[model samples]
Target: VNRSATEIAEAIDYVGGILSVGAATDLSFVNVLVMRDSFDFAADLLAEIARTPVFEPAEIERQRQQVLSGIQVSLDDPAYLAGVVFGRLVYGLHPYGMPHNGTPASVRSVTRDDLRAFHEVHYVPNNTLLAIVGDIEAEPAFAAAERVFGDWTPRELPVSPNAELPAPTRRVVVVDKPGSAQTAIRVGHLGLARDSSDYLPFDVALKILGGEGGNRIGSVLRTERSLTYAASAEVVSRRFGGDFMAMADTRSDATAEALRLMVDEVARMQRERVSRRELENAQAYLAGSFPLTIEAPNAIAAQVLESLLYGLDLADLPTYPNRINAVTVDEIQRVTRAYLQPRQLSVVLVGEASAFVDDLVGVGFDDVEILSIDEIGPFLTRDDQVVSVDSFSPLLPLVP
Candidate 1:
């Protein structure tokens, strides 16, 4: 949710300031991200957030305006609109389906009081865990923990019950953006949780599919076919099972073909596990790339922090790449059979539906009646209407 460098920097400052000892004191957490081990909260911080957030009205209002403007940007972009349709199709009723940034109605209604209440309920020490890293020592880190986060007495909380996910069914939702120049295509099913036994192999499959352009699926869809600028697949790992997705934006004329090609790619990968050389290249790429990335302060900090959050020891961290390298082709096929076989794959095409609707039906999408922006209202909304991911998660710049 921390979307920009300015926001992230400010957040880090906030964290350091809250915990630092010298004039060089680190700011509090709104600056430094407290990466969680799990979404579960720490009892102390949770209590403070729920009941005692010192929200400056001016700051709250600024954030609200920042959010409001973001909405307008999302509504105007077709690709952004397609993303919303896709997120909804997979996540259904989970908070994952909800916009990460508050909706307009929720945004407008949000008061300092609302945030305070939300923080206490969701941010308590019992509900949170922190992962710390860097040049800091363990003793001072613990002391900093007590100084900045302790003294949070226990309090009663609503037991966070397990969330229920909708039964899987495939259906296509096309959001008609009439006269648009391009079609945004997304295909895939539910994502696996980070802890799932199937996770590592699935990660390998995702890499082979869309992790890069020269890989098998990308080789067929983008390089050979020339239909899409780039087609990519990803398996997102969130608190629960994340949404696995493959997406591309192409000329509206090619929409139907693009969708079918993607569907065929899924069938291709599932039937044929990656070859030994592709697997070796992927492993070598991972092995060669990780150390260089590890050289940076932020990357090192992140690794340490994640370990703290997940409670992994030196042993768990180092063995990770080894596991990725050792994945058998059988593992890939097994995970595919288990998670990728949704009875119905939610197929969504966002443009000129009339031109491609019949083609899509021919390809096997149920064609869940196309929704006008007006119709998608009660189902999901921002104030009275819907906006897209453009508002929440921007297309962050590719690194230089």
Candidate 2:
């Protein structure tokens, strides 16, 4: 029997349970969590949803309209626009660059058969893993999984291998939102993979650089210079490469100054080792807060699921604090010098393009291009539109 989206949604809502669909570069997953007494009901609903979504033409068209509307709304948000362009710029043609919900054009072209073919290939017993954590005992949890899925035969999953990413090149992209009050800045380069040996040290270094209270960027830009209220830096990596992103939404007038200070802070990290006190604080922040983060069964299950997905040894989780504590100042310095490439950073700005284009060129950046929100695609094929840095002419001069 075909069920509407509202029917399926109402059934899950009746149990006061949660069901979410998530996608990543390597895989997509469904999650269901409910109270202990409602576990069996939740399991059955999840099984039904997973094994047999109606995928009716009307439902597909309804969802496609919703997704298209969402994409349109996201274009109005500066932070969202910046992130969308940043991902495309960082990942290029890789699958990681592909929008999880697909593009406006792509979504419109998806047929019911396309959805079925994708579901058939990806949603198989062999391709899935189940993790149940709550007040339930191990035996019952195991039995519940078997009862729900035991009859299913494992089949080979046909996943295409990801292509090799090209080397990153430094470029400055400006998405023009005229007369905007603030500029959303994203500056960083390609980062390491999740399984890199230097991940620990890089984490420590990132903490000192911009992890928390009064971090390097925040202290200098916000506290000292009063340029902005907040600033932060983080290295995010996936199965392939990631990007080290430093973001701040500063006043349009202070965009260039804030950018200069942020870049300077990164350069200083490579030149000078963090003091012992800074190192100790970063280690304490990571190690001391570790236990509190996993104080619940759901949190533990999530962590375990992440480990399994990434092929990380679950045994290493308990030793995380020890590894973090063992990081020395030298290791932070070495990792910073090796991985954090300040000169190779791609600067992305979403703001009044006329306000900062000349400023960026004045500050000596190359390959500065102005893009409209509609033009920020994975393949930005408008090389003829890129204004040469040496010959930049801003339409509007900076106010004040």
Candidate 3:
């Protein structure tokens, strides 16, 4: 049991199969992909590991060290600092604000007893859902599943505490890294929940606003203006509620200029209806690319898992193309004005404090406050007092 993870991994590799273990906010799972002939062995191996993790003291220590190291590594990344701090600012004390791996102090405090208790409580069959996708037949798959997991006892599980969301305001939080050559910016605000009626329309709207290839932000900030090599916008959809985020990495000198362009593009989406050509292209791109996402067995399985997890109708998958295509210009414009609130945008920047602090103030940014990377913890612990400023030009001309 001391080398349980290693043993299981070796067994999986011996059979030329791949195994993945991961935890999400809601659940933890182990996924195995094996050749047809190795299916039975893989199934049994996964079952044994799932039902019988030993929680050895040595293994716990090893894993704890790994987690601590990972947290430190993430802290060193400006992009990670921006994202974690932004989530805290947006969600307040909600579970969404907590980092998935937890804080260093929290992780260090974890004991083997705590692990066992958590596993015993949450690892019941009634609370678990297994998804299988492969060339295997149903009869064999069912038999294999029954052989491995039929006896997992069901139990009543504890309910998670309901999180009360505090409304976030439009404020600028800067994480000052002494010698950072570039600035990483995260601009966003609270967005709709997963099951909102406007989900499809909003999806299309986001695609037009910042979907990979020729999106508005990419066109305006990167290709046309050349302020940065990469710029994109995304809606982080979650079960309760989510946020709309735009990210870009630009030279410290170009920080204010990039922020203005990004904000201007978002304002444009809400102020004016997107052109007919843009709408049609977004629809066509989504419809045409839908099939590619689920082209593989594992891909299909992933989609099925998402549908089940999010309480979506399985029919939604088959009807996805029609739903996207049905989004009219009116719907996009309507949701843009309703949901995309530019006035409530919270901006986060990770850059050199000396290089861009005055420049940020010069650009008329309101409520500018400085934070160290270490301060980007629970609820983004404020490290400094707010710097009062009246107004500065929101413009810095850039040339290609």
lDDT of each: 0.61, 0.75, 0.77
Ranking by TM-score: 3, 2, 1
lDDT for 59 in candidate 2 is 81
Judging by TM-score against the true structure, name the best candidate. 3
| TM, every model | 0.79, 0.89, 0.90
Which regions of candidate 2 fall more than 4 Å away from where they truly are? 1-4, 378-400
Root mean square deviation (Cα) for candidate 3? 8.9
Better of 1 and 3 by TM-score: 3
Give the alpha carbon lDDT tens digit for every residue of 1-400 in model 3: 4337778778888988788777765446677777888888877777776777888789889989999999999998999888887887777666676677777877898899987877787676776666778887889888888898899898777765666665758888899998899999999888877778898888788888888533898888888888888888888776777888889999898898888888888889999998888999989998999999988766777677677766789888888989988989999999999999887788999999778777776666857878887666634433231121111111100000
lDDT of 1 by residue, 235-352 (tens): 8775455767888888877777788888887777777766777767766766567677667444555555444443346466667778777888788778876777544566667777
Q: How far is candidate 1 from the true structure (C-alpha RMSD, Å)?
A: 8.0
Residue pairs in clash, model 3: none
Backbone clashes for every candidate come to 40, 0, 0
- Report the C-alpha displacement of residue 342, candidate 3, in angstroms: 0.5
Native-vs-model 1 lDDT? 0.61
lDDT by residue (tens digit), candidate 2, 225-316: 99888899887876666778888899998888888888888888878988999999889889998998688765676677667765678898
